[model samples]
Target: MPVPHERTSKKKFYRSPGGAARVTYIRGKSGRHHCAYCGGLLHGVPHSKGVAGTRALSRSQRRPSALFAGKLCTRCRATAVEEAAKVKSGFKAAEAVELSLKPFVLEAMARVE
Candidate 1:
């Protein structure tokens, strides 16, 4: 049996050159980051098995630098900006925005000039 920490890890079997069987444990890889609004995979985020692995990456390598970089995809960011503009211009009411998009729109509005 594997140690306590590796109990949940997957096992791989291999044959040694001396004709002995060996087992190795492998921890699972982390899933890719996803956009908060669109539920699509976010780019520029590192995939690592543990916190230590992630910490090894530099700040810029961990996530994008743009606004809502880790949370929203480019397309959704554009949509939020557009919705915010409409709300600010009186073309769309604050309460009229979809609930899923309301928070993002408001965030964009806050950052606008």
Candidate 2:
């Protein structure tokens, strides 16, 4: 793949008021844009035609970011929160923890004669 040329600043977009920064992207022979993560095709991605020295927001871009409590999304966003909760032990002052059995706790008590 050709190193995407650093297009002129007039052809890029920056989150801030400044224009000194730049960004990068891929341009296929067919002139189709794709997602950087899954390579899925994208449309209306910000700054596809702006300057070259800034990070362009994808069509799916969300301000403040759902992971940081700025925004929200389905799927991975919720999963991230749950996983973060599980890893909370790392931040706890205690050196060790005792995780109780979940299924066993939920189980019904059988009749004991």
Candidate 3:
């Protein structure tokens, strides 16, 4: 007789499209948090423990910036950056150049007038 396999629910099986690319914290037996993306302990990584601190104190503290490395492991973050750079490189150079030159063109026009 063959054994029947149990079906898993979608809630437990499905992961978001961004899930693989994102960094999440998982509590470990050691009581230290681990990076879900990298499987590395989060101890060495710097993050703001709480938002209760004042703005000045927070600013003085070394916290992750908006574009700073997120919860993902270092390896994952590097891969993500590489992929983004590839996508950005695919953009038309002329469009980028135009955007960069707009301010200079405006300045030149002002000088001329």
TM-score of 3: 0.32
Listed per model in order, the count of residue pairs whose N, CA or C atoms clash below 3 Å is 0, 10, 0
> Among all windows of ten consecutive residues in candidate 2, which has the lowest summed lDDT?
104-113
The TM-score of candidate 1 is 0.78
The sequence of per-residue lDDT tens digits that candidate 1 reaches over residues 1-113 is: 55896788888899999999999888778788888999998998877547887888888988889878889998998899999999999999999999999999999999986
Best by lDDT: 1
Model 3 segments more than 4 A misplaced: 1-30, 43-62, 65-70, 91-113
Question: Pairing residues by index, what is the TM-score of model 2?
Answer: 0.25
Residue-by-residue lDDT tens digits, candidate 2, 1-113: 44346352224344545756654354523334443323444443333344342235442552333332222223333443443444453543222322332211112111111
User: How many clashes (backbone atoms < 3 Å, residues ≥3 apart in a chain or on different chains) does model 3 have?
Assistant: 0
Task: Assess the local accuracy of residue 28 in candidate 3 as a C-alpha lDDT between 0 and 100.
Answer: 26
Ten residues in sequence with the least summed lDDT for candidate 1: 45-54
Score every model by TM-score. Answer: 0.78, 0.25, 0.32
Candidate 2 lDDT score at position 64: 30
By TM-score, the best candidate is: 1
